[model samples]
Target: MENFDAIVIGSGQGGNPLAKKMAEKGWKIALVEQRQPGGTCINDGCTPTKTMIASARIAHLLSRSDTWGIRNQGYTVDLPAIIARKNEVVQQFRNGTVKNLEKAGVTVLMGTAVFSGVKTLTVTMHDGSIRELTATHIFINTGAAPFIPEIPGLRDVPYLTSTSLQEEVKVPPELIILGGGYIALEMGQLYRRLGSTVTIVEKSAQLMSKEDPDVAAVIKKILEAEDIEVYTATTTEKISGTQDHIEVQLQTAGKSHIITGTHLLVATGRNPQTAALQLSKTNVTLDEKGYVQVNDQLETSCPGIYAIGDVKPGPAFTHISYNDHLILYKNLFEEAELSTKTRQLPYCMFTDPQLGRIGLSETSARQAGYPVKVAHLSMDKVARAIETGETAGFMKAVVHEHTGQILGAAVIGTEGGEIMSVLQMAMLGGITATQLRDMIFAHPLYAESLNNLFMTLEK
Candidate 1:
């Protein structure tokens, strides 16, 4: 049996960084991965989705080139070319990830790893050979997979999850998406712009239900304007499929409707990738939802065993997973104080006129029993938005009425994701609205929206 200072399971954002940090600390480390080097974010999730979104956005603008006073005709989006470009981007990053891991002196074990016992792993190599390794510490960063509900006949039907959809190069004439979160919104828009008839079925009352109701409404309007059919407060009663097309039986508001599409895409939520790890052998515990329970330091119940990313019980974001790396690394080597509880993270949905929020929303703030003051500003009033012809959303800041300290912010507009960073910093640094209002901002920028938002606050 070979022993090392540390072993990291799964080579995604979380595992990769932790392995490097431990190795840099002069610890012999083994990084195990069953698939490609980079985790889902690089291989299937964030990178590919964003690349496709960029192509779709460009296609959308070109389709409306006449609005820019350019007389263009016979514009078409080359779906296969877009898919080819996405694949190239994914492959480049995957190769880079492998190169970096090798350069960092981390042993890359390409196989499925299972817990033989606490602090021990039995890896089954692709060639059908098994090897056992022991370590003082083990980090589990196995990410997540798309959550498919147990609807009758849904599994046997031909459908694509987010992972499989990334590998598809052909565009179907009609696509039916089942969910209304970020993935559904993004993919729905992409397929629609790429010349596919897209339909979205959301089981909730509002799409992007995690966002504030007003912000979600704005996004809903933009999606409808793009001609992507959206059905909210609906449920997929049953799904039947032939080799070429899928027939969906759906019910909404006491009415039954049947929709037929050439392709079905499931954009539901995700569940932790822990089933394969066989956690029963370790002291690490799982929550009711199957996510590994970790403390603020990212340490699991088992000593020296940590969990990060979607497999852990927290927000599942790439950046959050990266933050988990920093926390674990600091506690292991550096004397610097680090914990997940010390950070204020932000999340954004990448759709046209994106939706982003950090800290708390107005609803959550009031529910927490704080005397909250709200400052809401519509993007129509911002000069930059009017000049760019993208004024279709709003920004709202929630603050403590007495102290003027920014409590939270919710934004929905073009460049919403970029603009949220400023508010996120303010919330993290405990900056006040009065300070933001008095700060000099550059002229004719969407960031000036924050200045306008703070100006409306009651001092």
Candidate 2:
């Protein structure tokens, strides 16, 4: 048995940096991975998908070039070139991660690990060799995978998950996506912009079930305006088809209907990649949904084991995953006290007009019994949006009614994620809606519209 000071399972956002940094501090660290080194975000999730989305956005701009008085013949999309570009970007990120880990003197083991006993792991190497390892601290950052629902014939027929779709060398002619969450919307819009006929199916009453109804409405309008079909409050009866032609039987309003597509994408949701870890052999606890259970410090029920990233129950964002490493590092090596409970949770939906959100929503604030004042502004009112002629959504903010504190904010328009970061800083600094209204912002910027946005709360 090879013993180490720490063993990190799954070289994900949390595990990669944690193992590297811990090893840099003269602690023996071993990072084991079953596949590529950089985990899902680098391989399939963010890096590759966003690279393809950038190409799609360029296609959209070219199609609408006439609006900007540029009269030119339309360009043809080179699908193979797009896929090549995405592969290049993913390789760069993966290579950078590997370089960093190697420079930090981390032992990189390419294998699958299962718990043999407390603080012990049996690693099955790629070449079918077995290695036993023991460490004082073990971290699980295996991340999440697409949760394929139990629709009839879904398994028998070939369908694409969010991960596999990015690798397609040819753009889908007719794409039907199951699930109307951010993944579905982003991928649908990405393909639709790339010249595909897109339809979205959601089991919930609305897309983005976590957002306020008004925010969801704006998102729906933005999508439908682009000729994308959206079906909410719908149930999938059956999924049956081959790769060339796929069919989905749907049930809505007591009626059954069918839709056919060249490609089917299942973006229903993601589940933590925890089942194979054999946590039962150890004292670590998991929730009812199979997510690892951890305290505010992110420590598992077992003393030296911790769970971070998508494996834990909280937010599944890349930034949060990286922060988890910082928290663990500071508390352990730097003698600093830190916790995950008090940190801000923020995420962005990278659709054409992005949706950036931070902190509480109006629904959550009201449900939490906060006397809230909601300030809202349609994108049309923003001078920058009107000037750019890309106004398609709105912005909303929830404030504590009595204390005038900025509780949360959402932006849905061009560069929405950047604008939301501006608001996040305000909220972090305890800047109130009143202060934002009176605060002098440079003229005609999307952010300057915040002055007018907060004015509506007074009206």
Candidate 3:
């Protein structure tokens, strides 16, 4: 048996940094990881996926070389090479993370851990040995895994989840993606741009149900314009097939139909990876959906045990998880008062015309009983968008009419994510829409459009 100041299960964005910070503070640390060092974001979620998406984006641009006054007869996509590059990038990140943890004087253990008693764990080491460990404080940051929904024949047959799809070297000629969430939209655009016919089937009435209707509409239009088929409010009756040929039965409007594709991608969603931890032995309590329940300060039901990242009930973005680390570090080590409740949520979907959002949408602000004013402008009105000929989306901002404070904003166009960050900073500083409109911004940039976007508000 070994004892440490803390035992951090899962080397995720939160756990890894927290473990290193504790070690740097002269605390004994046991950093455990069953898989790659850097959690989903570095391994399968962000790094590898975005690398491939960048390649796909290149393919898309090259395919449209004519519009850019460039002459290109045709272009070919080497799927294996693209996937190799992605793998190389993932390896670099993972190696760096592992090295950093080792240098921090952390006892890095490769194992699956289960709670044997309060503050005690039985770790089944990767080399097939059993070890015991205990710590004063335990932190769970196991993160989440791709949720493969139960569709008849889906499990028995070979289908790809978001994780498995990352290692796929051969691009399917035709791909059918299940679920129209962020994963589906991203992979749909990715494969479609990579010269595959892609179709998205979503059970919800609309894609990205959390967003306002107009926001979703713009994304849908962009996908459809690229010839990517989207089927919303559609249920999958059953799925059957082999790798070369897969079929899915669908039900919509009391009618049934069949569609076949060369490959299947299940992008439904993700579930927290908590079942294996055997938390029953501890005082930690989980919610109905199996996420570790935590307070505003991110402390679990147990006094010294904490939960962060996707394993806890909250937004499953890497940035959120990293922020959780900051909150815990300051409060635990620095004796600073900090809470996760007040942090702003900002995320961007990596579509051609990226969708960057922060805080509430117009729909949400009004629904929450805030007397709101909205300002909206199309990308065509932006000089940079026009000069680049990538005018396919718009910008929108929501503000409290009485307080004049910017509430939320969403941008969907070229460099939309960067443009949205400008508004996000403004919101953070309590800047008002009128203030933004009146301020002079440099021309020939997507951010300059913010002035026009705010100016369109009711005067």
Candidate 4:
């Protein structure tokens, strides 16, 4: 048996940094990963998907070059080349992660790890050898995996998830996607731009069901204009077909229908990846949904054991996971007082015109019983959007009427993510909408539109 000062299972966004930080502090540490070192973000989620999204955006823009008077033709997407480029980017980031761990003197272990006792773990190495290791503190950052719903015949037929779809080199002639969340919208736009006939079936009443109906409607309009079919309030009954072709039987609004396509992508949701961790053998308790239960300090029921990122019940985002690492490191090692509570929640969905959001939505603010004031502006009215000919969405903000404070804001146009950050900073600094409207912003930029957007609410 071997012992270490600390052991971090799963080299994900949280574990990767925390392990390196601990090792650099002169503590012997062990980092265990069953598969790749970079976890979901570098290997499958943010890095690779966004890289492919960039290709899709280029293809989309080239297809409309005539509108810009470019007079271009014979545009086509080279699928294998795009895949190669994405693979190259992923590899580069993964190598950097491994190098960071090695530089900090972390003992990298390639195997599956499970708790045999409190602070004790047994690893089945990748080469079929078993090793026993113990540590004074253990951290579980094993992220979640794609959840394949139990629809009849869905599993029997070959289907792609968010992870597997990125590796595909061949663009399907006809693609049918399940779910209407961020993953579905991203992949749907990606394949549609790559010359595939894309159709999205969402069980919810609208795309991005969590967003306000008006916000969701704007996205639906943009996608429908791109020739992508979206069916909402639809339930997928079953799937049947071979690898090359698939037929999905579904129901929407009491009507039954069948949609056939050359390929199918499932983006329903994800569940915590804890079944193999053998948590029952330890004192760690899981929530009803199977996510590891953690206090505000991110410590599990077990005294020194901790869980973070998607493994715990929180928003699944790369930035949030990295913040988890920061919170854990500061409080535990630096003797600083901090917590996962009362932090700003900011997220962006990387579609054609990104959906950048922070703080409360209009619905949530109203539901919370706050008298809310709203301002909405279309992108076509913005000087930059009109000048660049990329106007296809809008910007909306929810404010507290009495407090004159900005509550939340959502941007759904070109560079929406960047523009949303301005509002996020204002909220963080306690700047009201009136103050922001009166502030001088650079001319003819997307951000300048904020003045007009808030001006409408001044009344």
Model 3 Cα lDDT, one tens digit per residue, 1-459: 899999999999989989999999999999889988999999988898899999999999998989989998898899999998998998999999989988999999999999999899999999999989999999999999988888898997789888887777777889999998888899999989988899999988889989999999999999999999999999999999876899999998779999999899999999999999999999999998799999999998989999999999978999999999999999988888898878999999988899999999999898899999988899988889999989999999888988889899889998788988998999999888888888888876788777888889865
- What would the TM-score be for candidate 1 when compared with the true structure? 0.97
Clashing pairs in 2: none
Each prediction's whole-model lDDT (CA) = 0.87, 0.92, 0.91, 0.92
Location of the lowest summed lDDT over 10 successive residues in candidate 3:
163-172
For each candidate, give its TM-score against the true structure: 0.97, 0.98, 0.98, 0.98
Question: Candidate 4 lDDT (Cα, whole model)?
Answer: 0.92
Q: What TM-score would you give candidate 2 relative to the actual structure?
A: 0.98
In angstroms, the error of model 3 at 404 is 1.6
User: Which RMSD does model 1 reach against the true structure?
Assistant: 1.4
What is the TM-score ranking, best to worst? 3, 4, 2, 1
Preferred candidate (lDDT higher): 1 or 2: 2
Give candidate 3 misplaced runs (Cα > 4 Å): none
Task: Give the per-residue lDDT digits (tens) of candidate 4, residues 1-459.
Answer: 899999999999989999999999998999999999989998989999999999999999898988788888568789999999999999999999999999999999999999898889999999999989999889999999998999999989989999998878889899999999999999999899999999999999999999999989999998999999999999999899998889999998898889999889999999999999899989999998799999988999999999988999988998888888899889988887788887889999999899999999999999999999998899989999999999999999999998879899999999999999999999999999889889899998899999999998966
Provide the clash count, candidate 3.
0
Residue lDDT tens for model 2, 156-191: 788999998887888899999999999899999999
lDDT of 3: 0.91
lDDT of 1 at 205: 96
